[model samples]
Target: MQKLLEIKELTVSYDHEVVLNDVNLTVHKGDFLGVIGPNGGGKTSLIKAILGLVKPSKGQILFHIPQTRIGYLPQINQIDKRFPITVLDVVRSGKTDRRSFSLFAKQTEEIAHAESLLNEMGVWQLRHKAIGELSGGQMQRVFLCRSLMNRPELLILDEPDTFVDNQFESELYEKLKELNQRMAIVLVSHDVGTISYYVKTIACVARELHYHPSNIISTTQLASYNCPLQIITHGDVPHTVLGLHDKHQHDHKHDHEHDH
Candidate 1:
């Protein structure tokens, strides 16, 4: 497969503290990579680095295609509801190549593409409505449509499942699977069990990164990678899978408990 993005010895820091340490990763064409880790485990940091939101303290991020070709769907909570932007405008804004205000002034093919994506996402009817008026699921769908407006070669989503119902989540994952047929995807989620079903590969990020070539990962492997997370399974009867703790870790925990 052709390489889309490459991260070489990437390091990101905040206020003199290292968030990501020597992380190396490669995203290839048609790759669906699921990023999983505990909260504050540098998963978001890595995404920020890739998106150029936070400059890396060291290393390089090389994109085979122009940065404008990368699409992003941020966590819904990060969006300010007070923003007065309409759904149609939001989606049209995703065309980074277009100059400001051209979204409305230009009746180009990009506008049609944006509308097509909204229709596909079942939000075409709500295009005129303000994004704040939409439900969480609707907002997510709108944002997804916006991300697709750019016709990106690589799509990056941060916690796309947050604040959405189970049905929408399932639908979103299925849609993403379909999108992967055309472009590479980097999905950041805390749910390992769920993404394991859709993603082609996995990366465990906790200050450092461990790339697992297969989506199917074991609790032992997660522990070895130092990525301790609670895995939730979805079915009629949902269950949880905890990370396996080794004797050394268990003993250390026990000793610390006894000390306190």
Candidate 2:
């Protein structure tokens, strides 16, 4: 459980508009950390900060590796499918940033690694297929394979399940579980209920930092975790009976109408 990354009082802004404020977090080796919150909750910004893609206005982000092999799988929805790129081409792009033109002159090894990753993700059948031709789930798997080609020590994914179905999601989680045995993973997701089973730690972000240990999260702890206040009920019951107050007093009016 050695610390791999640490952020202290991190603050990020875009065009002078504050997005993240006083954020703090710690990630350990072999940890599966899930970041959950509503849309526009600065989850992506936080990940970018950790990856050194976005510079924090204040505070610090300390990493264990000066040249870390970090893998990134951005939200699939953000990708332009009309780019006319093949799956193998997409996976090969991962090496372009690391391999120099001279080094790539004889890059059979890199090509083989990319093919192996595609096969591992069960997408080798579509290696030559155009990215736009693949289904959403297939496209996600392809990107995941590309991310893994770097042999990263830390993998960061933003909304990995956006376009995938339940079955594919299950497969993705299984792959992630296997990958977690080798590298630490940080995932930003809105699917909190599903991610709880896979992630060892949860970081709830909403203009601040709130860490939860795991699935044993309590209602009070959730509230303190910067999660919005939501009244959860076990069974169907009248709102009036639940003691939830409404400014218009609609529950009382509904009860009065029903009594007639």
Candidate 3:
């Protein structure tokens, strides 16, 4: 309920191209925010600025809690398949991010915690299996366990559903909803309409940013912000929002531009 994070007059640029422009936002405790935008949009840049991964061209990002209370799951976790790490080993790695805790000495309590998290993620049976042997969705579950191992108050997930499958898609959001009861969440994804049902608010990022306060949004509302995504929502069965008409229009425009 209290203000947790604030982004004021935020701007990020790469060689004057201007990836993000004068963005401003406020995040409160228990906020479940879904960030959606096109591929070349400034979603990644905006996230980087918030996490302090990249220097902002201008403005400020302030966090109410200690930086250690935040946990980040990057978009591409390019781990070498030959590294020979186990599922438990990867989950335990999250402990290293918390410098206050001792990394080397393993306590019986910590091992128990790791196993509990792995079981919750449905990968407890594969605890000792090589990470490379697991499927994409399985690996995502493992990384999620790792991210949550530290009990962070603010979790930032950049495209958490990238390599995820249909079965785990709903499950992941359900888990996130449960987690949101305790902490705040920021989820960045290309699937806007799908996430709209789960997130409390929607933030669309292009070169600029548009914040919609609720999950139920009209196509016109998105158009007002010049957001290019076409999201179709259903009142009964929740299905994918992207429409074929939008795709055809986009492709046609691309070909037209190529002709010139």
Residue-level lDDT tens digits of model 2 in 28-75: 888888888778889999988987889999999888853347889998
- Where's the lowest-lDDT run of ten residues in candidate 3? 251-260
TM-score for candidate 2, residues paired by index: 0.83
Could you tell me how far off, in angstroms, the CA of residue 137 lies in candidate 3 after the best superposition?
A: 1.0
lDDT digits (tens) for residues 48-114 of candidate 3: 8877888998999999987767877777555565678998988888764444445445555567878
Residue-level lDDT tens digits of model 1 in 204-235: 99999999776666688898899998777785
TM-score of each: 0.88, 0.83, 0.85
Winning candidate number (lDDT): 1
Go through the candidates in order and give the C-alpha RMSD of each one to the true structure.
8.1, 9.9, 8.6
Q: For model 3, what is the error of residue 16's alpha carbon versus the real structure, in angstroms, after optimal superposition? A: 2.5
lDDT of 1 at 51: 85
Ranking by TM-score: 1, 3, 2
Best by TM-score: 1
Clashing residue pairs in candidate 2 are none
Q: Candidate 1: lDDT of 68? A: 84
